[model samples]
Target: MGVDNNSISVSLEKLERFIAAALRRAGLPEADAATVAGLMAQADLQGSDGHGIIRLPQYIRRIRSGGINVRPDIRVVADMPGMAIVDGDNGMGHLVVSRATELAIDKARTQGAAWVGTRRSNHAGPASLYSAMPLRHDMVGIYFAVGNANHLPPWGGTDMLLSTNPISVGVPAGDEPPVVLDMATTVAAYGKVKAKAKRGEMMPEGWMIDREGRPLLDPTRSDEGFLMPIGGHKGYGLALIVGLLAGTLNGAAMGRDVVDFNKDHVTPTNTGQAMLVLNLAAFGPVGGFKEAVDRLVGDLRGSARMPGTDRIWIPGEQSHARRQRYRETGIPVSRGVAAELDQLARELEIPPLA
Candidate 1:
């Protein structure tokens, strides 16, 4: 069902076209904006409602405010046979990082393995996109990102000083779907909660809580609370480790230096992210690795489930399935996000999604 101006239920094509038009109107190069627009659409296709077309307004704001460079010539800043650091030149995160991943895949093909890191990157839509790139070449890709904002705090501390950093991994198989694992360190991604809040819905208890350690289900009160990390101290540690690897190692922002892009768009974010591509040939036979991965994933999915689950499921199955469904149907956006996009389109004097 299509939603009114007060709501958002847009077809996949409409969302993509709207984003492309808006981005181009914002003065980004056509090809660059198109690339980013396609990835953002894919984020919606994969049921990443929080990371998909919802970000258009924020991206437009950044571009118009001079935070993102419309014509950035991304280049390698430091290099070796299997290691390199890329400079994003303040371009759209999606375009710059995807280019970096391509570089990583090319190097891995020749060097057996490769590690690529980036600085001056913006918040890319989703990490899985880059990590899934190498799989088409029979290689495994691992990705990590420094979240644009700090929402989670160090374990045992009340200060919100760390981001809910995310990691994604993809492995290719012969006949079965590739095993893709994409997740954030937080119990729930901040986007989901923001969406829930925008829709005036209550969040689950475990997603967030106030400083007094009480559950915060009311999205309106989210500001007074902070997101809880998954596995408590363990997720906190993972976020920290990823920050060190993706940020500090690349000479990008870390700790207090990270610019909260959502609040301030004029600052150079200096965000850091990294991707590692491993050619299967380096370890063993391609067929062997694929077979092993297939078996491993099959085993995991076959595990006995508790009463409520119905059946055990692997990480990426739900997302892939949802993508298929949404592609055939349409993306269901919340009322508030649609309004935000409309406002942005009006400001840019471009066509908006309907």
Candidate 2:
């Protein structure tokens, strides 16, 4: 099965509208729902389709099942000049993180940098949005998170022990797209596996393997396997470190406690995560750093492409292009996603999207 390439890029505004409407019907206040919906839509614009509108149905399910709080009174449980810990009050991750990012940016403006962590934050879509906040003020932003669901086992264990645990870094560059690199520590994100499984497509080599060490590309049998780390043991190490910092350090769920939001929607995720914002002026002039970043991107693109390659693409180039195009055309929800969203709207008694 193949999708029409011409229909792939979705209009960003429409996507936000759909999500916002859905959340309101699910009982979230209009303003809070719109804020989260807008962020989710922007995730798709940035090429994080798995983290974007694809999560709408799950979010709805969580809210209806009393898992996620619709009117959470998010607040800071701990605070300092350069650091703080947030209590999401079982609210949506989008609201919790937006608050944390704002707090970080405000404090960074005064301290030249700041770090913020959040506990009890639910799934917040992609990490890039939060990481890109400081760019408006000429600051570099970095974010990491404990995946709401765990899909990987320890190097030698069969028990699902860890999350894909993504990391996103955004660095502003003069006259060039900010160098934003958002990637899962796993060779392939768990979403890719789900997509493949849904489409009845086999995954490419190295995406996963059975516990016995044989390649497992048949996504249909994914439950019997685990995701492969990016570079074998090295990637596994990084995932472990991220789990510690983003999960354990934040005093949130870890190890066997991570509830699979997809499988069960009634449990409080208690997801933990942390981010650091670095003011460019803290190191030097913002202009100089941006120029250096531009040069850095230029240098990478100037490198020779491999045989059969079209052009050298930077880490965030594809996402940047997607953002521009999707901002023009509404994001494509695919026939399957649309059907799911429609079903959710019915359950909530909300008017469905066209």
Candidate 3:
């Protein structure tokens, strides 16, 4: 593998193999490592640049430092007909959430709807990864997570008590691509800020604010400020609700207890995440519902556009387009991320990603 025109284009197969090898070197079982690698590669394929292989080095560092459990016995601590609570046993979040989403889909198939929560999980990839899981089953999926680190505070306060607290929802459609909305409660995800810093790019003014509430545009000064909520008080409220539901409800770390996984590699994050599945068949014929969704999506996209606008887009439309382009052209890896991964491969005695 080699860089082409200063951009490293990686095939999904090669990316998965490289990630699995790194994880195996970090003590993860082969099966578990491969499972996670596939999910991370899928994230990258879907244009989730921040949550994909970009986080591999950090995950491997945590695993080597005993912060993550390689062979976790993820099990349901409490079970009901339509709901369940899982203990991830401090395993990789991709594994834990995958299991949880599967369980939710299974339960939803039988009970019309299902909700599953997990604790003791590490940082999972993008929220869309789990939220989109149920689309294949003709069911809608919703996912929420308390971010691994706190980057925002309550409105009118500077206490830094809230994480990005992302939420995502995926809805199946008939003719149109599935509609998926994935977003952080903040103006920007902390991972995006970190990525900008790594690339030596400046942050936008609205992304963060300093202690005195001045706009902070320098990515390197991220620690000197805190992320801004999307809509000031409203986004702060949403973040609070998400944290409470994903963290407090699941008996996992939240607020001040969140460990900055980017800074500390030795502490188990004990992250909390929740997923819900709704069976479309429960309401009506799946085909009819999907057709209705397609109609709605079409109506939205067909609306008149303002001046200088090309066209309208549904929530997941851009991601779907990006996925197709990336699949055809290969995923692009930034130079900085490529270098870091190369260094990691050398340390683990595995082949470099190139």
Clashes within 3 Å, all models in order: 0, 6, 0
Summarize candidate 1's per-residue lDDT along 1-354 as a digit string, tens digits: 566554556777887888899999989888887888889988888878778888888888899899999999899999999999999999899987898899999999989999999999899987888888899999999999899988898998888788878899998987678888998899988878767877778999899989999999998787788889999999999999999999999998888888888789898798899999999998889999888878987888888778888877777778878787877767777778777887887888887675
Cα deviation of 188 in candidate 2 (Å)? 1.3
Better of 1 and 2 by TM-score: 1
Superposed model 2: Cα runs more than 4 Å off: 1-10
lDDT by residue for model 2 over 148-232, one digit each (tens)? 7787887777788998998889888899888888888899888777666655578998899898989998988887888987787
Cα miss at 67, model 1 (Å)? 1.1
Candidate 1 error regions (>4 Å): 1-8
TM-score of each: 0.95, 0.94, 0.98
lDDT of 2: 0.83
Best by lDDT: 3
How well is each residue in 220-303 modelled by candidate 3, as lDDT tens digits? 888899999988899999999999999999999999999999899999999999999999989999999989999999899999
Candidate 2 vs 3: which has more TM-score: 3
